[model samples]
Target: MSDEKKLPLRTAFAVSVSKTAAALSRATGRGDGSVIGGRLGMMIDPDLLAHLAAGREIALVSGTNGKTTTTRFTAAALGVLGDVATNSFGANMPTGHTSALARAGATRYAVLEVDEHYLAQVIQATEPRVVALLNLSRDQLDRAKEVAMMADLWRQALAAHPKVHIVANADDPMVVYAAGAHPADEVTWFSAGQRWQDDSHVCPACGGHIQRGEAGGWACANGDLRRPSPQWTLLDGEVVAPDGVPHEVKLQLPGTVNLGNAATALAVAAKFGVNPIDAIPRLGSVASVAGRYAQVERDGRLVRLLLAKNPASWLEAFEMADVAPTLLAINARDPDGLDTSWLYDVDFSPLRGRQVLVSGDRAMDLAVRLEINGVPFTHVKTFADAVAAVPQGRLEVIANYTAFQDIRAELDRVL
Candidate 1:
């Protein structure tokens, strides 16, 4: 590391101390964004960035899915403009984000993926220049009130922020509504031109009906508009044409769900006056976002990690797999996970041909559902157990946000 990049030991120590204390505070009871984000808030609330003008910028990516992907893409695109600091490890709350800033020493920009529930607190504390709200869905039923209920909370939170420039998914009625009503300094909409929409949940604004169009993308029957056909859409080809990564499609990641995510990131950049072509190259540079559809090579076998804790995420994971030969699942509890009720809601019929292994704390729950769904399975009681039983070929593992650490850690150890 360069001398300029090196931070003072005492400063780092102090930041660590504060983070430790804050994390401990939330070690018990139901922890909200109150402590997780507040710790970093104490570090660099608004006052601390006063003198820094290397065109310092902070960007926030929040929503149910693609927050991490959007955060990475935004950071990558902004990195083209200047030096960037980001929390790619998902420490997106205020405190964790602050810790990243502290570690970065001096940086021109900061990109973070803030959680949906904590959006208000994170924004109130960090004051990002741009806030991207990805499509919301049914996630964490145990903790979150309801998908629509949380959507209302999201609207309220975004409405409170006035200075931040916002980018929203126009295809999602809820997201569009939030963006359209945001009191931000400025707002822009981004869409995939009516492709890859997950709008099956219907419009959260008007009681209008939403339908899956012939193209399989979601559309509202009402005049509620989409981002006017995004100026930047991912060209389809086998991974090499749209730009060059090499595959059957112009995707660095899997699933049409992620194609929408990629499109959203590009649109957000274009909305910021960034040329879509100029930023498209950056997308090629970043492909596998951790815990999303992160494909890792273990020996010669491909093990794709599908981070699917929510109903929509599970749906996306299954869609992307295309019924792989073997599938594995992990659902361990850690990093504040919730009970698994949304599992019963996921559609698993396409998985009939694939052999499956389910693990995690809720492995039995998923296995039972799989059995009822008629998905043939192999036996594995835990991630460790699954590791012993994994076949040597293309494999898929869908894990919750919390199980990511445990499952990935064990995979590294044994796979």
Candidate 2:
């Protein structure tokens, strides 16, 4: 329970204005209205987010990847207890948090998807009951902090808020280092496996080599930093809860990465006093978050949309996608980070035998990378072209941030 206070007159006015602006934005077909609404509200009252988060139980999910889906899962799992207000769309900054809280007035619980860079700021404002750290990796490096720097920010934030319980990944060294800032009892560890270890070869504590054990563990060669023993562990499609109870996880979302997210969500739900048995079923209820894994029918072909912003996420996307012809869209927009150089960081070898169709503003960059990786690809202009190039069947379309929105827009318009 939180000491939620009555909103001040000014803040109430700001909230009202924000909701109106967001509704108008949607009504006018400007956008989803989440960002516009929150921006207007925050402009009216700069401290609008803190003011709204004053009296509710908050859980924040932050990481380089999977934060959005993990936040969705945490919110759904929390549904077993009561209604949870969350930013269902990918608008995951201060403005988005303000809009979500303002829109869902009087909700007792909120599970927010906080951008990795803004994790500290959100923690300071919301004073969340539980902060779930999924995994720290290289993402949007041109706009965001480096992996170690982001981990340090998380460390400082957790240290400042000692009372906030932490549900963090033990497999990721950087996540372990950050979550270690909290005292033992205040932290809950989840052995959600990290598949992309490109950014965490060196220990964050010291520049020592991180030695990984075959039995799922890691330690710094010359420092005390090591993988924590997780209370909740994900084994072959099942989660073993803290009480040593094993519950099989069956999710509508694809891939083993989502299974790890399910484990992390269950851990966060447990901190809020939700039973894994009662909440596990709710986890299955979420088929997609935002438009990440949504399958839309275009030209009699079932096209699945998967978003991969960086190398780490691209790896997971490859695993989730089918072996059929795949469309890879890239963009260097502000939201997608103005660097396609990260494409070099992704191993495109998985699409070697499969048909790969490249599109978007950075299609040439993606094509060159695929060529270097010895993968064959055909360049296309639009989503319709990509669909036409393939036969009438399942086609997987993977894209970065803004390009994904573009395809989704075209998808809606064409349908």
Candidate 3:
């Protein structure tokens, strides 16, 4: 890793080219240009991330779900201390990391939402001050590493970086195993409330079934794994601190899931010396994070955009779709992961009695799932067509990765 102050001529040239590419991408309406630019930059300079992140304090946020929202919240919370550099658009790869740091100029603090697989490399390069480990679950099994494999990777990575402080979720057994390498005092555990425990039923240590007990406690049948005492717990939508003081957390985002996200972010913020009382208000200010819960008016229809890439995320999104006339979209693009089979894991039975309109390149796939679940659905060929189908009232538009972005982009043009 070369000093960023005196970056080599090639690395500097790569940065310039990457920035120009990103600008051109945005101008042409291709995309946000964050991923492409970062991709191009990393190609030229293999160590571009290390170079740009030199001499900066970093807080790496990683997990199966809620990484993007948590990253946004943590970055905003850290703003109380100083300007923070972050990959705001949910790009959690090396290229994205390079692009963010390259554009950040002289920012001292970086809060990055890192992919579970890339945690080791990013941590080695940036040497983050704190690492926030959210819940781990099976996501994109066809493309992503298995839950146990990812846990092992995290355990090995965190074991090597023992100096880094850890903010981990105590309720998740996988997260507990991953952060177990760190000493008790070095880790700050938070019970964020896990609703989807199907993937985490087995203990990562002895392969024994994890048993859940009262008060959000869990222990393995083999006595190898158990939940740790959490410093922060989300109790009935309120965030309780280590002192047994509960703070009411209000967020512009909907669902108990966002409340959990806020809890984890608040835990990280407190470790950075941000007052929870002050940060709670700041967390609420985040109405929508990259179109997660954004409402847009298009053609006289109020459409709320929600993103659910994996089954766990879908479970959360489905819980929030209590409104009528919903638009469900699914895509299997690179960003969304090529495997659409995870759709079957989501219980779409809740949408059984509603008027469900489906759209996306994989609309038929979702249509089939809805039909099997006994939910009547119509497959619209395009997002616009689906939006047009919802004649009036609030239309709940829930989509997977790329579909969410496409719908959000289309609505942004009209709204």
Segments of candidate 3 deviating more than 4 angstroms: 1-13, 413-415
Task: Kindly list the per-residue Cα lDDT of model 3 for residues 180-242, writing each as its tens digit.
Answer: 979888899998788788888888899999999998889999999999989888777799988
Q: Write the per-residue lDDT of candidate 1 for residues 33-59, one digit (tens) a residue.
A: 234543553554332222221245777
Model 1, position 51, has a per-residue lDDT of 23
> Which residue pairs clash within candidate 1?
37-94, 40-95, 237-249, 238-247, 238-248, 238-249, 239-246, 239-247, 239-249
Please rank every candidate by lDDT, starting with the best.
Answer: 2, 3, 1
Q: Tell me the lDDT of model 3 at 382.
A: 81
Q: Please tell me which predicted candidate would have the highest TM-score against the true structure.
A: 2
Task: Identify the runs in model 2 with alpha carbons over 4 angstroms from their true place.
Answer: 1-7, 413-415
Count of backbone clashes, every candidate in sequence:
9, 0, 0
Error of 2 at 338 (Å): 1.0
Per-candidate TM equals 0.77, 0.96, 0.94
Cα displacement (angstroms), candidate 3, residue 257, comes to: 0.5
lDDT (10s digit) by residue, model 2, range 1-415: 2233534776899999999998998899988788989999989778899999998999999988899999999999899888889998869999999999999998889999998888899999998999999998988888788899999988998899999999999999999999887889999999978888889989888889999888788999996798888899976678999888889988988998899899999999999999999998889988777888888887889999999999999999999888999999999999899988889888999888998999999999988898889999999999899999999899999999999989988877331
